[model samples]
Target: MPGGVGYLLQHCGAFFIRRVWGDDLLYNSIMKEYIEILLLRGHNIEAFTEGTRSRIGKLLQPKFGIMKIILEAVLSGRVKDCMIVPMSIGYDRVIETGSYVNELLGVPKEKESLYQLLSNMNILSLKWGRIDISFNKAFSLKEYIGAHTTRRGIPLNPSTSKIDRDLLLQSLGYRILSDINKVSVIMPTALVGTILLTLRGRGVGHDELVRKIEWLKKGIEMRGGSAADFGGKSTGWVVDRAIQVLKDLIGQRTDLLEPVYYPVKRFELSYYRNQVIHLFINEAILSCALYATVKQGGPIHVQRVKINPDLERDCSFVSKLLKSEFIYGPNGLTENMMKSIEDLTSLDVMRIDVENGTDGEVKYLSLSAEERRIGRETFDFFCFLLWPFLETYWLAAISCFALIPQTLPPIEPTWVDERVFLDKAQFLGKTLYYEGDLSYFEAVNKETLKNGFQRLKEMGVILFRKVKKGNENVTMVALSLDWCPKTALPKPPKCSKTGKGSEEVKSNNTIFTSIFGGGKPEPKISLDGTDTPQDYFDETWRYFVPEGKLWELCEQIGRYRREGKNRRDTATVAARVLSLASVTGALLTESDGTGWIKKKTSKL
Candidate 1:
């Protein structure tokens, strides 16, 4: 089957490799030998550290397999020295955007095939605006190991089965990914996507959108990031070109533009938006912290607001809450918060005051009412960047309530399969959007849900376990026993008729409770039979498989055959019975071994 293009690639030095999940001794030995030969022959090797393409445009966590292999080669003296060059490639449009959207929507990804490749060849004529590639200065692996050597003057050797060696590999992988993100170019499509998505279901005037694009470009540049060049073309031209490239996903009104296809296309737009999310992440965190302060009855005084412990604490909490989503520099959270404050002050959006305190010289942040009024546009820009992420986390928190039992102290904790939980979360998110309880539709994303799940686990609010189901190991989740729902979950925003301010509508409790919260009244089913609060949920959210019926049918078929009855006819009857039983739904109770009691059903 390796013909045509595959043959050409193989001839061009491409080789097949498989993911080594276990101790695949033979495969590992062959790969290690192949890599060593390449290094010894002075041939340059290129690898995608992430191991696979990210469904979202953001940089995925690095895979350490090949990296560890290369490191071992150098450590074993097979390769004298190897320079690691990190590279970043940005695209104006990704060809797989549509498939990525489908995958996010719970559609299983299709495996690659030659037929699909040939069918997609027509896309070669499509206008993909620009591709920007940047490479970071190469760092010598030998030198890095030498620099990190312990006081004992011992370099990291693969032969040593110590934790330090593993730590070194992890740190090295993160450094490479960080360097790649640093040099990533901000394309016009990414800028346009960020602006349009920020507006969210609203239309923007062409001139206004273009102005915002220019403003965002300036902000990125000010933050020590690069914007793609447009060959001296005006901002309007850049906007027009980007729109033209994305015309299918974007739509036009009289004099305004907006994203088409509602939530699905929003995922595609978010792909571009995530490319440059790192650039504005710090400002976004600060903006979220400031918003939280205002929501908690702490007014932002025009004169001054203390920034030392309180503001720093809030910022650190926000950063940690989103730690799974964004990558912070090696400087850590406090340092990054201070830098963001300095950046904001330099931009004249806020002023700083140095005050002599009992402990030391404390700093105060002040936003002059006059300055705020003048720079409202810039201030809103930063705050809007964080709205989607905050909304996503809020949705994720609310979805957890569905997993809890109606009783104050349940007989036993209920554990639901992780896949079922996320499916229910997505369904709940869509229902909320329709009912106006949720604002950002894009927040109902699969990737963000997974990331939020990881963050919740890190915060010790949720516990995960693996259980064997059928032939697969299913990941199951349950609320932590030590965690109380009443004090942990964020308060739900008031209904739409309340006319609450935007800040109040999205405001959460302490940053700790903000990402995950508990203690709300049990949700009620709507009056309409079509919608139920617990439609996707039950005492046990497990699917019914009717395994007993199928086995019984097999026994009957075997008995009929022994009695000299028509074996083929008996098997057909069993197949019909199995098909009918598969479609029947049944409620499972604690006595059925699910270990969770069902709440009494009631109409709203």
Candidate 2:
């Protein structure tokens, strides 16, 4: 709602105006009218590039729908070329982070309501850290288009279905994300989270933890990124404040006179750490991989480990291996790796051989063995960040490849529902997590598996279909390749009773395959023995009459009181009900955020 003063001004006809929902962009009439009205009045327009708040902390890839509208307006001559300014706001603590975490864990976001609004007012009393705002210099769309003009004077139009226009948009999107990361606020809580998470929840001694924080702070600053205040305070003092911030602001306990993770708060810790991971991720990847390569036998590293990376070749190889794990720009892995290598060189983390070439090939120095022995913790932290992703990808690849036909079958199934594929992926993911093959942040993350599927899809390693299944159309993802032996791909070695050195070596060699590169049981059985969670959700849903809120109403049905029942248990029940309702025709979630059982389709 508009403020009273603004309403009064509007009543007095200060200016002609109308509020338009983002949904209006979906219709051609609405888009034309909105564009015509804005152009007629020469009004400034604003839109969120990401469309919505990121469920995960990083800047999401910008939605092209709104961008398409503006591009169409310019191309159609409905509006003149305008200056597009990219603005980014970084918060030390996001107001909706709790909801975001839940959503990331598969819980649907609760619909906005007055009660929720009032409930959140308590946040006003909480101490959220600073907000940093950054505005990039405006660039003219006309100039951008003109630069890509052909000799015949034809301007670049996204509507033209040209490769050039697609490339331009991709570049623009990456540029915007890069700008947002540049202005990201590096709070003490974020730093502390990074250390604890990277160390795999291990405690660091007081002096060691303090030194790590200082080292990290200096690295972030050197890269032109901001860190929470460290000036005029002793190292110990800064460390104490960081610990307090973690406890008071985030409710994490890291002070045992040593920094350690609180098991219950690991997810929250990861969220904070992710905010700054991109800053040093590249260096971490390089240094970690190199360190692992050098300390081969004692640790019994993977066979693929390269003890000495040939500057250009091996850097590119490692970067490609890490593609699914990190966000990369349109310039792609090679260029990004080269830039990271240059940065590492500048930081004195590692040096390149400038004076002499090794037998007509490029050569560079790895960190000294002494340093690796001392900095073992630091490298492990970096490598661990990539561990979950690699493990999840490996699980998906192994599972999917196993499904492929080793011998010719009578018939090949064209597709499997996307959900079924994901269920299998999640089951395997959960198994790996339980076996300690995955990281804390990724243990229950089906989204990571989805990404792995997407990467495989993009590479033609897998295929999918949209088909009518009962009353609904479902997506079915399938492998494109025939089955092959485990030996052909990277596989973990068989476990032995003694667990010799080779066994340890084999254990460390994890595998990954990605298209994007980038659970529970019930004992309840009804008379028909078809009592799945979906059935329970369907039956219980009827008690709420016309519609029920999945979260609030389900809580009552399940008798989940906040006091005694764990939040995760309640959250899991709610998430599972919603998931079941979505898959079967049990319930339909409306735009108004209420769930109603579908007519004549209650049973599943």
Over 4 Å off in model 2, which ranges?
1-26, 147-159, 228-242, 248-264, 288-295, 298-335, 342-348, 351-359, 362-365, 399-410, 441-443, 469-472, 482-604
| Ten contiguous residues with the weakest lDDT in model 1 | 581-590
The sequence of per-residue lDDT tens digits that candidate 1 reaches over residues 22-116 is 57788788888988899899988888988988887788777998899888788778789999999998889888898988777666788887888
Tens digit of per-residue lDDT, candidate 2, span 360-466: 55445554344355654554655555544554554455445333332333145334446544554454444334433334445445555666677666655667766
Best by lDDT: 1
Determine the C-alpha RMSD for candidate 2 after optimal superposition of all C-alphas: 14.3
- The residue-level lDDT of candidate 2 at 335 comes to 69
The TM-score, computed over Cα atoms with residue i paired to residue i, of candidate 2 is 0.67
As a TM-score, model 1 comes out at 0.75
Worst 10 residues of 2 by lDDT: 507-516
**What lDDT score goes with residue 297 in model 1?**
37
